[model samples]
Target: MVDNRYTILVSNEQFRFTRDQLESDPGNYFATYFFGEFAEASQGAKELVVEKDVHLFRLIQAHLRGYDIFPLPDAAIPPYMTKEVAIKNLHRDAQFYCLGKLEEKIKELELMSPNGRTGVRRDSPSAKRYKFGDETWSGLEWMFQDLNNDGYQLMLGKLKNLDMAIPSEQPLIPGFSLTFCWAKEHRYYVLLASDD
Candidate 1:
């Protein structure tokens, strides 16, 4: 008999877990969708493909195995997994998966300022102008003549340092035509032209 275990392909990595382990919790989307009685049965070893970050998926898998998502005691996390990139990736994946509890935990981590405070600094002029609240920021709508490459880079750096989460959806900036450039190392920037 073909083993009933399933293989999940995430990004370039393949993860194997038994049908039982996957179905152990009814709350898991994979379990509910793949292992439910109305779901199609697999003839042999089943392969499911997921378009997600593999490293993040591993953390999600660990959560499925009854582990709490981050702020896990430092001892519980592998040294290589302690970086900000890993946490950001995991948070993005959790949001994609609609794992509400895990998403909340990751948001808490994201909101922590460098000094261990719960909020970001609101002192800078840019910070005062752009940052709306804990998460949202005002979209930029400066006239073309008002912003230059150096100024844009400085603004981006400020945002990065503040750990601001820029919204992926760019709403049309009134009276400004926007252009995006993907420079070396895949860095993205938006340039504006005055519609006036």
Candidate 2:
């Protein structure tokens, strides 16, 4: 059984769709395109492309721009596959992509200003906005309390968002991974994993 001890604070289906598209298509494309372009080029050409590589950057920009009209080249293209290159590219993409979501999360956290207040009118637009309703807050509160007890600085960290904003295969922190998602339908959903 999957470990359910960790909670899902929020789940953004669009975010998930974006991640899936990246992993399923663009991610593979860039991995192959770059490696192939490198391998097929002469040593001098390889250095030139390395110094001025545009394919991977373009693909990343395409995804970042959130445009889907431009069809990704079919995978029928032979696998110019290089595991090391693919892995490295995947890591870079993962970090950059997660950081973008991290920014969004930061914005949400910023919305939660003066977090320690209680019954502070509860009329402000931000208070009207609760992440995943109360359940999400419960789980987050648990984690925050635990982390605080363990000496993690609460002042240094806020519930910007959850790991559910990122892909299941990618982890921002070591050991434990958790994702939080919030969408129009489901106010909040979370997925957590502990390689325990």
Candidate 3:
């Protein structure tokens, strides 16, 4: 991961980025200043100092590094911030960096925000027992087929974006496991798990 790193001082705090990482996006603000036909590029400066919020810059750098969503939003941002304030700060930095489409992606992530307003994630180590221990071999296609045969429905429309936004290979749905539970409303909650 270390490839001749460069230091960036943001709001009196130091952050580092490798050469390829600085130039990862050809059109991004920092990438242009470091590699484009600019005066800074001529000097080959090893460090950059910018006056910006450190927390916001962290989110921007994560975005530049191909990370779209934080697995847990609360832990990613400053602890003192409210969810709305954090989202606002993230949006501000995203626009300031001229991050194309990141604004929309951030909004998409905000929709799935698990901040106790609508839902939240609880880490139950015993929930590990639901780790697909007894299930026989079957792929997503076959699993969905079996669910349908059992009058269980796989809600594709709701899960599509959440799956892409989350880092896990297993999809994030109503419940967080690879087991199917019967709902009183005649609905099936099928949670998928992977050997992580």
Candidate 4:
């Protein structure tokens, strides 16, 4: 007998949940899409693939398990994540999944801060918006000129060299690691390195 369970794959992670748990709320996107009689998932499909951040998918699962995603408690924040990063990731996932209510809730949370600021500001600049294109280089120029002109020129040269060898569709260079971090003197740094 086939078990009444379904596997949801997000990024490189797999999550299994009972049919009942996913169908508990009939109006929910997951429930409606997976359990409705005429739905594709209801035709004995055993697995669904979701191309989203695994961490955000875990939070979405928690929401399905009767946990509210908004108004996140301080205790729920992961050790390596700041609350702003957590909310931003959740918001992106919610938006991608067409979870309007969840997106609204996240937006609400984003607009308010514990200290009454407009929103949570990170000490480091967000590199999520960066892409592999001329526009990205332009944006980097604007950002880096304010930090270190020499470093910006070196970085641009490196990026141009990489661009020549790698296709635009391939954002990740084989051996290089890219990271954003805060630096001394109130500057933000984009660090890139290759194994060589």
- Give residue 19's lDDT in candidate 4 (0 to 100): 76
**lDDT winner between candidates 2 and 3:** 3
Write candidate 2's Cα lDDT for 1-196 as tens digits.
Answer: 8321211111211111232333334434323332335453223221112221234344443454454312235431224635334324534654554534423333333333334233434455433222222223323322221121111123223443432353233223344445343323333333333333
Model 2, residue 104: distance off in Å is 10
lDDT of each: 0.52, 0.33, 0.54, 0.53
After superposition on all C-alphas, the RMSD of every candidate to the true structure, in Å, is 15.5, 19.8, 11.8, 16.6
Order of candidates by TM-score, top first?
3, 4, 1, 2
The prediction achieving the highest TM-score against the true structure is 3
TM-score per candidate: 0.43, 0.22, 0.52, 0.46
Clashes of each: 0, 8, 2, 0
Kindly provide the TM-score of model 2 when superposed on the true structure, using C-alpha atoms.
Answer: 0.22
TM-score for model 3? 0.52
Which candidate order results from sorting by lDDT in descending order?
3, 4, 1, 2
- What is candidate 1's lDDT per residue for 1-196, written digit by digit as tens? 9777777888869887776667544455566446644344433327778897665677777776667666555544445776665776676766665566677666555443232232434453333122111112333432222333334444465554333233464435565554332222333344444453
Candidate 4: where are CA atoms >4 Å away? 24-28, 37-39, 69-82, 111-196
Q: Per-residue lDDT for 172 in model 1?
A: 51
